[model samples]
Target: MWVFSWMSWRNSLKPPDSLVRKLNRLRRQERPPKREQGAKMGKRPRYHLQGTAFTGIWLLALGFLLFLSPPPDTGRCAPPPTPTAELVVRAKFPAGKPQPPPVTSTAAILVDAQSGDILFSHNATTRLPIASTTKIMTALVALEKLDLNKQVTVSARAVSTIGSKSGLEQGESLTVEQLLYALLVVSGNDAAIALAEAAAGSVEAFVAEMNKRAESLGLTDTHFANPSGVNNTKHFSSARDLAVLARTALQNPTFASIVSTRDFALPPLADGTKREFHNHNVLLGELAWVNGVKTGSTPYAKYCVVVSGSTEGVSLIAVVLGAAEDETRWKEARALLEYGLSLRPRTLLCDRGQLITQLDIGDPLGRQVNVVTDRALVARLSADQVATGTIFWEREARFPIRAGEVLGRLEFTCAGRSLGSARLLAAQSVETPNIDLLLEFWRRGWAPAFLTGRK
Candidate 1:
């Protein structure tokens, strides 16, 4: 039975002649045998040692080839994580203590000139005839557009002007600078007309320009029918608009000097006579800080005034229209100026070009770029209200950025309300390593070099 089993196993193990010949050829190719195999016992099967060795060698070679190849990855480079929003807290001013409103004329407003903030207003937007106070804007426009030393000849029509003696003879010549002083100081109607004609070739044309300028400056409720506030049906300005106009006019240093002066002497006339003029603004003499502006009165317009002054470091402007009396207008204007100066000044919230955040660009080299705000963030609040507000930053940044690129935005919020927002920009450029560079580093085994090059 054992002999029969051995015979069956040998028959099953036999290969075709072609395969047997190929195995014999492979065995012949070998240099020599490392060890001899034992002979098979009688009635027991003997395995071929060479054939087993050859099979094991082939299997080992196949395993080595498989090891050299990288494995197929079901998951490799992952997408970057999404950024989450964060909340920020800040301080703000407390509510100011309430106070009783002050009494004032028919129309009045006291403003902080530097901040353009109205501290007190009494029918400030009511339109009324501003009388000669309109000369402030006229003088301001001339000062801005005309060269101080440029000579101007008085026109025959300017000499024939009615009202307000300018002591000018026909054909009298003066520099633009001298005319501005005469126009503002004594409220010269002829000087105003002459300046208008010189600036725009005619008073009517100049009035058109004045109205155009007023519209451009956001004076929606103002109309100028004449260069001087001569009580025309079409000429009217509100106390609020006049305050804005006066504040704008005072921004020009030349206009400021002209208005502030107590007295000015005009250039020589054709008859070799000179005219000296005193300022019409009465507050300049009483208040140490009061500089110059204008005052006007007519039976139809009542009394009006635009007073500008600076006490300590705070500058104030007050405009009053349709006052019951001239002294009352001055008194109201003074009270408003005092109240404005009493309030503490507001500080600008941020400096220009401040760096707000840092953005990460997924460079293989691990480089980070900084993001900054394009313009400064600024807020004006009363001193008491400065402690309660909050500021927050929001960014929508991405990877692989260039310098000067816009990344996102920085927003300012106070008490859950958004006050303002500014754009965020990339402060530096970030570059990613190319495949060749990465492979070279991997080959060299310098792992730290790829990770440590950020600025």
Candidate 2:
């Protein structure tokens, strides 16, 4: 059986003679002529039809790209493009000559209510008696130290106060809110003393607190002799200092409301008679923009006024000290406020998210990182200086780079002086890479800019 199986396998392994001849003939058949294939696979000369098709497609794409219109020319009824990154620009202030203010006050200052930027100044820091505006500080202390609804019994000391009386008598009871109205609206000395006693348990102790508050505020030329703002040689403040004080006071909502009130009727008297009083701040309710604030006058202090007003989302604080007459205080205050509000703020020089500049980080990673400002650059310059300021920057940037790290400062200058400075911080972190890792990153398709040394 083994022999028979071997014989069958050998016969099957041998091919038929006719089939072998056919295979050999097919193998010897000639192939068609071919083009030389240089050193690569699949290389061939282009045919006319193939070339025409490729050229047509390319021309179509090129024509489509060229169809776009060019950008509009500047100053031709079109807005400028929004800038993503920009070089620091230079501008001058007071675009034109500014006329002097019609001011008759001995000392005065105009300031932005929120930023404390002095807009206009004349004898700003020369200390002189502040008169009844002193009550502003007293009201601030009371508001901070006492509860609004807390009842205060008018004392003999409060009733004895002579200047600008609120008509409170001994043993009379009133809430702190009512006393504040009397203090701010009527400019009453008695109301001030009552609030002082209510807040600190005594008038003397409250005066001590007032001095301490002045010290903490860094008022170099301010001293408070009394809470009522009576004419005292020691009780003096500058126009700048008073503006600072009024701006701080106006931040309190209760104080703001009280000063702005045209008139208020008090809680009924003991005999059921209603007590009504009007604001002494003549500007309040008289002008379109004028609001809560204070006015004062004495023989020695002349006339002093601290007025705060807002229009079109901008608030201004104006102070006039030692004006020649009562009318002079109001006229000078209005003039100062007009000047402040007339000076429009410039458009944003640099937006909060806009890239201010680039910081170059030499080698390994071998590229630069972007530095952005943390806040918007808004110029608070006088009317003439509005859009005319120069920008400067710190030229050096350090590593190891970090996101949100403060890198440098952007200073805005005009007339050879700094107007303001904005901080420049890193927007993205870029770490230095080791040589081996850097080479590996490049090999594995790192950014082309990094590899080509195009900062």
Candidate 3:
């Protein structure tokens, strides 16, 4: 029985005769013929080693890349860190002194239109694009060079120019005054081009004239590259310069009237229909204090406005440039004008008995006299101006001064302009020197040093 079991295990291990014959036949068919020496090289051990090494290298590289890669996100992301607020101190002026109002404009200025005194400024000299505000200069140049009633035929070029049109047709005829109304009240680019052509025969010539006029007006930080106030690299003006231009433009009655008008209708077109235009300045009817000026806006210039306001005899011009929105420009301009008006006019610059200076009269007796202002000098001045005014004493008092006697003139100037002046008077009488004292003064070659002041 043990022998029979061993025989059965051997039979299971051995292959069948028919299967062995088929395996031998397949091996014979796949075998390659042997090559002669130097005829062609047989399969090399080096090739097999190189292929194995390449496979290993590729597997190692793939493993290295997997190790370096970041892990996949499996959960929700956390929110960003919250920012903390910081307290920033901008200015530390005196508590009582008026500070400039917070505004959104990149540049702004407030000026006394009557005296041309700058009441407030923020980046006033920085050059910035000024959109339709360019029409101020255009109107100024036109009023100076063209007649109001003269009719001008609209050119195809003017009508073809894009932006802010007044519905002007090519070959249409309109008077200079009508075009000016359209240009100022409506801020029409077509009217601007037409007026430019009418004034100088071409827009290029008119732009040159505009720059020439800007130079003549001493607008050092301003330049005009076009009449329509299109946004251009070469077209720019400063807040301070725009204030000056608006002040000058307000002086022209016609320009002033056109800018102040809320609504105007052009004469009927050839089809017997009228075209009505309204002022772009929303502050006109909304705020009683706001008067004539212009509004401007473009992609580069943002929202800009030059506003003129008069209240209780205080006339002011406020300029806001590069405001983020139309409402921002109007709000900031009104705030500036109101701020100027708040500074009371007719401020007492100098008190009646204020002692300006003391002087020695060359009396030989070593006598000093008090030079006091006889009357008060008052004028419209901002608080800052009153605090920093300069006095110019024109004449010095002579010897033998009497009480209440007008010795000489003393002028009070602020910001390069004279506010008011008063006569310097002796607070008390000073008797003339005796003959011997006069002789001693003459012998000592003593003279009054009042011009430079003794003390």
Task: Please tell me which predicted candidate would have the highest lDDT against the true structure.
Answer: 3
The global C-alpha lDDT for each of the candidates, from Candidate 1 onward, is 0.69, 0.73, 0.76
Rate residue 323 of model 3 by lDDT: 97
For residues 368-409, could you state the per-residue lDDT of candidate 2 as single tens digits? 678788887655444344333222444334445688887666
Stretches of candidate 1 above 4 Å error? 1-101, 268-274, 345-455
User: How many backbone clashes can be found in candidate 1?
Assistant: 9
Return model 2's CA RMSD, one decimal.
17.4
Candidate 2 deviant stretches above 4 angstroms: 1-95, 345-455
- Weakest 10 consecutive residues, lDDT, candidate 2? 69-78
lDDT of 1 by residue, 1-455 (tens): 65566445434533346545856765665434344578443431123454556556434433443333222221122343344333343335347653524665678888878768888888878888888988877887677667888888888777777656567666768888878887888888878888998888889888888988899889877899888788788899898898899899988888888889998787665567767777778889888889879888887788888999975346778988888887888877887776665464344444456765555544444456776667765544445443222223244334445787776665655434455666767788754343333434443554234223422
Model 2 CA lDDT for position 395: 39
Q: TM per model?
A: 0.55, 0.57, 0.56
In model 1, how large is the Cα lDDT of residue 35?
A: 42
For candidate 1, which ten residues in a row score worst on lDDT? 68-77
Per-residue lDDT of 1-455 in model 3, one digit per residue for the tens? 65566445334433336535644554455455677877877675554444445445434433443343222221112231232221111112334655567887899999989889898899999999999999999999999999999999999999898789888889989999999999999899999999999999999999999999999889999999899999799999999999998999899999888889999988778898878988998889888867889999998999999989876446799999999988898888888877776674455556788786666664435667787887876555554553233334444445556787775556655556555567777788876544334434433543224211344
Clashing pairs in 2: 91-388, 91-389, 92-388, 93-384, 93-385, 94-384, 94-385, 95-384, 259-292
**Residue 348 lDDT in model 1?**
46
